[model samples]
Target: AQSVAQPEDQVNVAEGNPLTVKCTYSVSGNPYLFWYVQYPNRGLQFLLKYITGDNLVKGSYGFEAEFNKSQTSFHLKKPSALVSDSALYFCAVRDIRSYIPTFGRGTSLIVHP
Candidate 1:
């Protein structure tokens, strides 16, 4: 089974400050981790993924995440937060053998200007 956990239901940050959304996962084999952001009434947009290379991975909208093998974690990060960055963020984990990925409940990121 593959599972992802977003511990916090919501995260608040000021504009221009760095922000993080915590995520953890469990899988049987190699884990493929992904981060996505959902705008209200819109579909989830792919942010980043940890597939093969370095533990530290960067992605769209200046987002990044570090994959910790030992902890089975993949927490998303942003150098600076924007009010526009406020959205629902989701963490997903997939087992290579599985066709579909399992997503977390999602974290609501609120960036105040």
Candidate 2:
């Protein structure tokens, strides 16, 4: 079985400081990893994906993630946080042949001024 875990329920960061939201996964086969962001009362927006090749993948709004196969982890990162960046984030993963992806419970990112 494949699954993803987002240990933190929320992350608090200053507007100008860097931020990170942790993620870990378990899969039977090669996994397609993804990160999505959701604002209040809105659907999730695709932030990035890791299919193959590069370990470091960049995404929208200056967000990036590193795919570590050995550790079975893919953590989201940003050098500078913004007040507008405050939202909920979800980490997802799917097997190569699976159409339905499993998502983490979600992590609330609060960027303060």
Cα lDDT of model 1 by residue, 1-113, tens digit: 88889999999999999999999999999999999999999999999999988999999999999999999999999989999999999999999999999999999999999
Which ten residues in a row are the worst by lDDT in model 1? 1-10
Q: Estimate each model's TM-score.
A: 0.98, 0.98
lDDT of each: 0.96, 0.97
lDDT of 1 at 68: 97
RMSD to truth, every model? 0.6, 0.5
Any runs in candidate 1 off by more than 4 Å, and if so which? Answer: none
Candidate 2 local lDDT, 1-113, one digit each (tens): 88999999999999999999999999999999999999999999999999999999999999999999999999999999999999999999999989989999999999999
**What does the lDDT read for residue 76 in candidate 1?**
96
Q: Candidate 1's error at 27, in angstroms?
A: 0.1
